[model samples]
Target chain A: MSNKYRDKKTGITRREILKVLGVSALSYGFLGASSKVYSKSTAHIVIVGGGIGGATAAKYLRLLNADVKITIVEPKSQYIFCPGSNEVIPGWITLEDLMVTYTTLKTHYRINVIQDKAQSINFDKKQLKLEGGDTLTYHKLIVSPGPTHHYEGIEGFNKELAEGAFPSAYSAGKQTMNLRNQILSMKKGGTIIISSPEDPYRCPPAPYERASYIATMLKDNNPTAKLLILDSKDDFIFSNNYLVYWEKHFGYGKADSMIEWVSKKKGGNVVKLDASIRAVITSNGDIHKGDVINIIPPEKAASFALQNNLAEGDWCPVDFFDFSSLLHDDVYVVGDSIEGDPMPKTGYIASNQARVVVQAINDELHGREVGSPFIINDCVAMAGQDYGMALAETFRYAGKGKKLGERYHILGAEKNKGKQIVRQQVAENWQRTFRKDVFE
Target chain B: MNKYLLRLFFILSSIGFSNSALADDDLTGGLSLKENFELAKKFPMPSPWLLSAQCSACHGTLGTAFNEIIPPLAGMDKQEFIKKMQEYKTADASNFIVMGIIAQPITDEEIEAMAGFFAKLKPEPLNQEKIPRDVVVPEWAVMNKESE
Candidate 1:
């Protein structure tokens, strides 16, 4: 094979020397002494998680380099995207519509798809141990084991409860369907309580979007029903847009409004979920009961990163230059797992971070300096099918040991009906295009 | 002594990087000595391909969009792409919404590099047989001779 994959050693090998000499002589004969030679590499890149970040890493890595072996270790064969999953709650979209398979990554890109869970990482040996007891060695590793929902963060709420009555449809899966079915079957004029968690969570605008969409669903089916959003944080992303939409449609801020939002200052931080009584206890000891409860739990770096000592507190710290893990060399952490602030946790940012990491690894394999990273997050959120909003954020690499500098601009909620409809359509188009970009 | 010399060689080699390398200085105007030194210590600017890849999230892969709410960028006229991007970057808030803000942080040279990249790409055809969706072009995104 190619000399680009020559194993690292203290001195150059004889074959490499001979290859260089042959290249130089051939260049001298063909053109001149100025021609430089580059070749394909045999380096193996192993990625954890098969969500947006992991899938994008596999796809984009193939685009940048053809010879390097890329493998993705994901337990599920198909992924249900969380971007448009909020639409599943109101029957605007189905879970099947958001599902994507790894078949394209395998057949088109020739990537190795290992349908197995990543057990742990052996940093010393640079090996990732899979749940099936297979060990895969890699020249570089990318870990994007998306965020873990700590359902226990709210006392009395556990995984079983989430699967049953109080469905936290944060991750778009069975819980998403459960939440939707709960809303559909609730008694007329029944109350639905959606407990939104604090900051630094995946898709910051999702919980609010879920609230808005569910409000629309209620307006159509259960007109007299109430939807209360108890938020842990004081305010949320796209608050202006969501608030404006809520007021116009759901009679928000009125005496007999269909929808009401309780911020943390107003005793909305849900500390406990009393499943026995179908009530949630706020931090201020206020008990609010509901017929349907959807608790979006607080989050932390996935268990894979936490157990392997890749996390510092709740997230993994990464060098902004390439998203290489600060704790381990030759290892990278992207997506919601990294301590990426000044950069919110969103799928768009995660995919962009994956692109940066692969470029860095490809550069290093080619014996070149890894490039500085610039990330852009074009966050698109919809308050309704006809109303959408967007935020543009750009992060620039500052230096070694410094967070990437950030600039963000968000448009105020659109007042023009035509613009709002167009933005909504654009958001819809983006979801379909983004899904194909990563998986297909 | 040899290690230091090798380090110096890499730093110096980075300065006059070839077109294939796509160094920041090679694409952009140029970097100051201080900026170059900072780069020498860490990493140089990312490739233009990586910068443009960010658009695919909304604009479609390589700007070959299946729908037309947002205009595709693949096979766009080089100068035309540059002009629109420059307009978006320099235009007031009322001119556009998200693209203007997104274009603000990106350097003009980066935009030029991106424009050059999209100009060369051949956009993939929409497989209408598989993806049966209607295309609706927005008013603001409509191309005109004056804008070009």
Candidate 2:
């Protein structure tokens, strides 16, 4: 240890650098910013769904506790991220880049990655029944089974339409390819209609971002193509940014504009689809035809969560502070499944909620009181590769029966060109890296 | 214009620069953390390690609580973190071959995120009792606790 400081070139090791730097660097300046805890206890923690939320929960649980036995029950061997997956529309990334497996969680963290569907939970006995006819007992449980689309809710649209001709592409695997192909093969002056769902959807900015990217692609090859967005929501997350991007590239609100958005207030809620005629009927009886129709339907907690009675209405109600399911004991739901209203079901929010749940469990094991939490969502969205905008909302839990003290700090559109491009790159890099952060 | 004079001038300037920087005994890389915090706030990722790609295998999210032998990047002064990483990009940054080799292929943007992430992280005193697993408390952490 004594020779650790001996450097050959300048006789300056990292030890020398640390000593040269003052102690104020760690003088509780950084540490005092937040009260973080670390303690361990032995217990079996079972997490269902190996997507972003469950994977993150398992990782943080292991990071905070060295001895907890964590077993993640997921059906698939790999999880494909949906964060920047809309880039797949414009051929920015492949589906493989979004895919991640459970090898690291199993080998490095000593987490048991069981490849099977979590059929049901025996709440009274604190047990989980797997589809493979095995039962596992747990002291704590996390249910992060992500969204199950209600494709049939829209008349004349079902799983088949999403799979073959009219693609939803919301789930980021097979349908993604279908949508990309349809966009590529779309005829000159052909219209691609993107019917967006209402609020509380995964990545609220996706439909608009999808439209942005589709328009971007159309400009390169099919410039005469028109992309109409029939949105269920009146306004989207980053409306201004999308408008600006469309105006600059596709001539928004113009006679020859390639992009047009019809909000629900303006009869954008699509009711029926005539797949044979390649057209859709909106709520107020207006029929708009398109060459390719991508209908992103309303969502709820996955059938696994709902069938097991994890949801209150369409979403699983949870204690916001700890993300513990309000419906059942020992069950916590994070990610898109949770009734995290005002919190759009984004991947980052899900990951942050996972942290809260982990912290709560760790504190419980250590017999410490979990304090009021401050949840900050740096919700970011980019319009194409050039323009980006964000909403940084800080949510502080005021108390029970009161809403979180929320404040929005937006990275508005007025920022310079360089910052926007950097943000776009950061958003792009974040998707690829977040996949690794969760699974690997 | 001559080759010999140019070589002499380059060596003299390099030597003079190193001596002056070494003479002051001030820890380099002391950029204003406030300014860095403002910039890092603009970034979307929760932490720099997320953006650092493969580095998170050893480096934790905010670059603290690493293995015992290696030092953590957390709470290090922002500018100092940048300087050490800039040095590590060289094949000969240290006699111990690993740091330089691992850091050699890192980009400028990655280095910025690393520096900014660590600087913005909340610091925690290395309590021997807290970290039951193998973790080395650096001399800086030790000195801070003792002084407090």
Candidate 3:
């Protein structure tokens, strides 16, 4: 109500300066020199997908910063782990053993678990729209929606065919169980065909492990059955190690062995599939019939990420330190959806990435200087009932000024008899411990 | 009046002298040029042979521990040890909480030295000859249900 005049040196009113000084003095007295006041009331972090990566991020973020509000939007109420699902086909572990619910995350961790799929994201506005017509506003969003199957490559391979004829069983749910049941119900002397896609896919060693487990089961129950692996690539990451284990345990090199591997370089690439005939046509114009056909198609980022304009080419690109999207500032992608040069898309790698992203969010909220961040991964592949191999790597990020350093392969191995026993026991322990660490 | 002026001068000089000493102390402790160089050299420096003796306290005479919870470092991969040390420095990941704490203060050079020393160590059989043959299984293996 008092008259105010602008200063000659600057356009700001003298009263405005006085008011600002008063507010600054009060703030300084209350919070001290180091503290900061952010524009938002509280940092709201929303994580999509309830897989290992997403769940780990949600749990760690809540633990690190209790003040930050965390909400997890996952379409599924329960998750069946894909890591140990290979054992299901061999009857080593049941489907029920791999099932995990979000009760632990909701009750013990106090993370708001919502049963909704994130339909769309408005990055500019920092808002996410759910399929249920509800809108959620978040200060930061972590999207680890996992990988979606690429169905366009094969002629007669689609969702319906994958379910009924040859199930990919890649996403780890009912399809995985269905595929397991089909394998169990097959004839004793039946021929099983498993197709492996090229590189840049989920779980590089998984297809080989599946073949190994299936061979183990066949040898035990139906010794006359033959399992053939048709690989798109000539040399696989763990082919040599798996081959050694298979030869030692299942007599893989013998003429009447249960398992056989055919590389594309050796003329085994399946060009087209006839689901009704239960046969696949090779690129060299040869048709091979099988009692059961399992085609693991190529993969891309989850459908939600692609549809929401969060992907660059096939995968999402993120800043290695915070895992924030390069395309969108507010959106952060982790797990198999993001393109990490050296890190493989495995469960352990995703969980490690989640921890890094959670720390970055905490640092941003607390106004603390971020440290030099590092991401590490370990991939374990079980080739037979007892034999397995492991690969581990670590990636370090220099600060903002310098480029990130090269990734280092920390550990790698080939399976042996002594190591096999240790690996088998460790695999069971890892499945239980890792699931509890992330979900519980 | 002259005495009071002299006293004020002495007090002022003492204050100036203490301030300069504080500045020097800060330079030595914090991220100054000298400190950075010292850290760089200390971090990647190799450990002496005596350092292996220090590890023998809890890890046994060689690198084998009393139980499986303490993994045998003998024959462990060199690069894996380095990466694991770095992970411990970040205070992330599980399965090695104590190792992480022990490794927190160790430099990269020390890690390399330890890894080299341990890699060369021959795997010694546990001192189970004195114990009864029926009690051969380690306690951890039994608890984990991994006993043969």
Candidate 4:
């Protein structure tokens, strides 16, 4: 009814309008009888964050419905993928190798990419207020801002210390290069401490992979140097594989072993950091000093989700059937921000969550019932360049208000060198193809 | 003015002709084509499309993978896909890196549905231009690129 939407030059007359209405009505009847047809509604779906979840939602939604207006609000113009970033430490892959841009999303998918930070959300108005003072009204909103690293989780360990001396290279940006430089330039016989956080964090196997990669770097660069992993959790995802690799390559169990892991049960849970002395204090009041410290801080839902009341305590809760936020009706949350237990916070899971949400939205637009969500996470991890392991976790929806039922299958470390090498090659190829699938 | 009105009339009338004609014969359960379509629209479960989409992470969207090691599933023969999946599901654990495990949870009905879904899609070859300039495409992958 607005003048902006009207054809000004043609100036539609009443007779013409009536004719169009009558014809369209008849066309709708014929099309409805013949096929399942969904008309183009002026629905604008606004997504926050341009990580795997948001990007996948935008692209997949466009695939399901060609006419819905999709807009993504993210601060960064380029996203450095975190999946293969562990290889960056050992110089096998560079940061640029994991970098992806929004060019394909904009040009090919015709998605509106607003390189602006989302400030807050007005739930009642269904409008997203941006930091640049622009408010975008949306029919539905998806928030996938990833996790916010809670640096204060460890006393005396803050963001400033993380960026300055001790780098928690969790998100694969400047800190990743920083950690790599520290490892390359450390003293001979020096110790590099990696304080791993507890469960319910992003990439459950990342800290161990980081240790393995750094061990490889030290074995070549500083042969006498030591790598210590202080885990807040008693066990990790790929401990069996990592142990075998470390024992074979670095003499993990020997008295003069190059790499050592102290689990929380063994008083390895770091409670505080004495940054001035480059030491971490464990739960039992033991102080361990290192030449370089990489403390991966605990994480919570992103700040935007917290500010807008999309989260409950630490993470946002959602109906697993469609990943719609439990707090807000028209808003949905996905990725590391959600309370998706049994589903490790991985990019593959995030992409699938996006697919479920988009499919639900598309079905609702067509007046169809939202279908069940079946998510499969095929996680491929590497202990070293030659040895790789993979796990397949399937998450099935139980019902409303219940957690997704999960079944996990992970093979132990490969004993055969040929099979291990092939698996490594498969893992490497999967990273490249995954990048293309999400971005291109 | 007369020409504009005539053009509008043609455009309006053509809207009904855009789609192909549906079969007039009654389908299974003795339902007409429209009734069957309605029944399908109301079907509570749609696990096939949802299940097949999760494979996009490693297999590429709709299984059109460009990686040399991971075989693309789009345009694969339905019977072949079903057989391969069943083999992986029941084969020795060491035979496959992850496919054996990944295929275990899916039911046979879901497998057939997924097979049919992927079989209908035409596989597309990788567009070399879409490959980022800095990425090092493996020699095997580059050599194995199929013509469109």
Candidate 5:
């Protein structure tokens, strides 16, 4: 009804505009702009997936422009975070602690929370089809379907195998628990085979973190239990710290070390699985038997993204300008769905990508030129509860049609115990705070 | 933009901004810190950092403050914010190599706007009803002393 919203050429008022949008304000997101806060924007933004990236996008979009219509289409009403999910495996944290709901997103941010799976996107019509054949239209679409583990990539593995006996547990839900329970009940002096996949997986250091935590969990309880980390990559993200911590605590590098890492160079790549016997066949044709096998298979963008033509190959190509799909206009590919190399696929990185995309969209609505992006990743990793580590990197846009240029730095080993404790404590705190930041 | 000139300009500009746009700040005035943050989302930001997304990555949003390694700046003293920023700009801040890299492109004008935006949010102290988070407020990070 405000005169400022008048369509001069069509003589249509802003009230008429809403009437044409026709959807219920609550059903389609309708947070009115506070005159003292922000200018009203009529742009409609839709996001798929309600994980860290999508949720953050919805929150930030509202913060930047109160009038922008935002909707999130997620299959599950509750989201389980994969970050602190590692602790769940060791019983250090529960799945409940890692769980969050979309209620706050709907109530506090006034974002439309559609409890349904986004079936397919009608790019031509700018419409997203829900499960029941219902549709929602948008001016911009954000795709943040997290990574999908390629269990099929392994000769003898599949999703069923991942969920049942040979648990991938990478996505961090029921499988994480299955894996945890399996380790807890294993016999004393048992060997647990944790086969890690190639590079470019989510949280590059996580598999190692899991190995460390698993080692700690068994240090006192099942003292002779050993953890075999068979990795596809020759080297991993935090080998320096992991080896040091492993040696100090688990007597790593000794004859009866608690944890033994088999790098790719040493025929450590697990090419096949024998779930019946709880054994893994590496590329070098070595069959290693174990009491429990955690096959964290290689990963690719979620199937939904690939099926809907949002991806080029293993991942979706994005414009550094705003994370918009390079192949599709008005469609943004964020989180693990993106092929952003040098910038690892991490929750921290995904959240940052969401921020950049929303800012770019907001700028476009204001009829301003979208500036080159400066993406930063503060990757904080911890091996044990006592030693924490951090890697800080900056990715800046090089130019049109080029991926982002990069700058990297990481915290070095400290000599003192207090410094190590501080980092470790901070890592724990960061996990809790980051969880609340997105969901709470 | 010289830092001093930028500060002077912001001071001159806020005379009008405070008198007009902020005249009806009733919602934020009597609300709880949590309620204030929910309301602050609607508050318009200044230039360069028009969106909280730019700073919120490392700084954490109002909902989640960074671990004690990086101090929360929202509702922090303006002069204190400015001093820390200046130190980073001049490469005088030790143990903040990341901040130095991030602050390189931030202009004096942008710095003023960042301070103004946080101060206006009126963030309450992080004492009672603290959100579950991993945060450490070490002395080096808390070098945000106000200008007397």
Candidate 6:
């Protein structure tokens, strides 16, 4: 009773003071916790192009950060992979097999799919302009627009010729299908000429792969048809390996063989193509007549990239970490459109870059530092049925230099019968797994 | 009357302090969500000049031209370039020797710089004069169709 009277005369009790302090501390903690939770739930990332790079990026971004809002803008309704396109030329696979849609990507990964081409990007405004007159505001933009064929350099070769006489099935679409149809319909003894272009084109091994597939087709279907490869360079990067495979599969080196590779050293470099006459004039003043001519002319950035002012000289420059555009910081460029040393313009590389970009964006969104990134790529070219050769390497960035980590070669020649079977299995598994990784 | 007024004022101040403390606790609990969301929305943009300086060494000043060895960067495919550089780092199949070497030392950040440099470059016609037309294609034999 005495204590109570004294406390009443005094101001407050110890328990009450503690209760007030606890409530204040708890309120501050809750506020900090809620902000963190809300921040992680609302990250928006926009990717341009629906190719391997962009699609992979969209998928992986979701995987890395499930809370992210991912939007992919592309012109095409479906994506046709260029990786396994050689099989199409030989009629081993159809165009339907190569086609993939964003619907599957969207349904499986919760990605937003927009079927429209990006016309321009306002870096300062952090907005992207679409050809449909719509603008999208994004926190980060990843551009993966592919290449454009240069048809002006070659004399008498343009879009019309590409549709009819000379088809550069570089871009995987109707043009690819048309080229396949043309090759299949050629006469038994008709001459087929495949021309290689100057450097900085898509798929370094593609031309050779195309030649191999065509030669295989000719050998099996039309033994009398001759396939001529007129190369622009003296020697290609994988010349030895490709030639070895050619010799083993096609009766290469024999005069009666179906395939003939004409390198620049052999004076068979083509300077001009007379599409009307179906003749290819070489630099040595020689004329070669062909029933089918596949001329891969010079290439530059895609038309949309140039029109949008995203191009520097011939290519788009971007930041390596997030694949953001250098000219326009808000927009990030991936795949073949941006410049990267040591990395080839291959689908696998694009996919790898996509993963890196997605990771960086997610980390940035989370207010976390991006860890060291490791990018790896491998290119496997099918020489014949059940026969494949591959090249692989890994890279890391070191200030101004790109440090090489490891390089590997996978060939089917060194293995025993049992091992060969395993290697084949590995190759098949790789294709299936890779397809799922990118498309599924 | 003065004593009664003082007591009233004291009671009101105590009540006001308690309410503010409750409100602050509520705000603190929800702080991270709003702040983090804002940070995610505000991504840092890279400097264009930094990217250009790096690209000029290989792609030439403003991506004009270095030599026939290196293709002009102007009007190049942004996706293709990025993809190619990634290949070089990972050993994806490519023809250029320098790309693999150049990409070896690059970071995703540096790749971004290079991409940014080319993205800003103006499109130009390829100077094809230096392109060697005399390079030979090895396997073709001058065949007379009439004789065959």
Q: What number of clashing residue pairs does each candidate have, in the order they appear?
A: 0, 5, 0, 0, 6, 105
- In candidate 6, position A263 carries an lDDT of 82
RMSD of each: 14.3, 17.2, 19.5, 14.8, 13.9, 26.0
lDDT-sorted candidate list, best first: 4, 1, 5, 2, 3, 6
lDDT of 2 by residue, B1-148 (tens): 4443354345435433121111121111212323333433343323343333123323334345332323456778989977887775553342121243234333466578778867876533433232112223233212111210
After the best TM-score superposition of candidate 6, give how far the Cα of residue B126 lies from its true spot, in angstroms.
51
* Model 5: per-residue Cα lDDT at residue A11: 52
The reply for model 6, stretches above 4 Å from the true place, is A1-40, A401-425, B1-148
TM-score head-to-head 1 vs 6, winner:
1
lDDT tens readout by residue for model 5, A317-367: 988768999888789999997899868999988887888888888887887
Q: Top model by TM-score, which number?
A: 4
lDDT against true structure, model 4: 0.79
What are the lDDT figures for the candidates, one per model?
Answer: 0.79, 0.67, 0.65, 0.79, 0.71, 0.62
lDDT of 6 by residue, B1-148 (tens): 3442344345434433111111111111111323422422333432333333333323443355523233456556677667767766553342222244335444565566566668666744433232122222222211122321
Q: If you assessed candidate 5 against the hidden native complex, which CAPRI class would it receive?
A: incorrect
TM-scores of all predicted structures: 0.83, 0.71, 0.70, 0.84, 0.79, 0.66
Could you give candidate 3's per-residue lDDT for residues A1-440 as a string of tens digits?
12223323233453343344335534544675432344322456889899988998898787676555567899987777777877766667666666677776665565667788899997755678899876676777899999888866777788888877688887665566667767777998999999888777888888998988888778777788999988888877666568777887778889978889899988778778888899988788778899988898878899999998888888988887678888887678999988776567888778767777877777778776553355434455677656655443444454443333432221223323444444454455456545545665
Instruction: In model 4, state the lDDT of residue A137.
Output: 66
Task: After the best TM-score superposition of candidate 6, give how far the Cα of residue A174 lies from its true spot, in angstroms.
Answer: 2.3
Give me the displacement of residue B71 in model 4, in angstroms. Answer: 1.0
Best by DockQ: 4
lDDT of 1 by residue, A1-440 (tens): 13322323313443343344344435444664321223335456889999999999999999888776678999987788889989877777767778777766766676778889999887765678889987776667899999999999999999999989899989988888788878888999999999999988999999989999999989988999999999999998888788889999998999999999999999999999999999999999999999999999999999999999999999999999999999998899999989998799999999999999988888877878777798889998999988988777777787889887666667677675656665676688789889878987
Candidate 2 or 4, higher DockQ? 4
In model 3, what are the clashing residue pairs, if there are any? none
Q: What stretches of model 4 exceed 4 Å from their correct place?
A: A1-39, B1-45, B131-148
lDDT of 1 at A122: 78
Ranking by TM-score: 4, 1, 5, 2, 3, 6
- Model 6: per-residue Cα lDDT over A73-192, one tens digit each: 898776776777766677666556565666556655767677888888776555678898767666677888888788766777887778665787877656676777677789879999
lDDT of 3: 0.65
Residue A271 deviation, candidate 3, in Å? 3.3
Among all windows of 10 consecutive residues in model 3 chain B, the one with the lowest summed lDDT is: B20-29
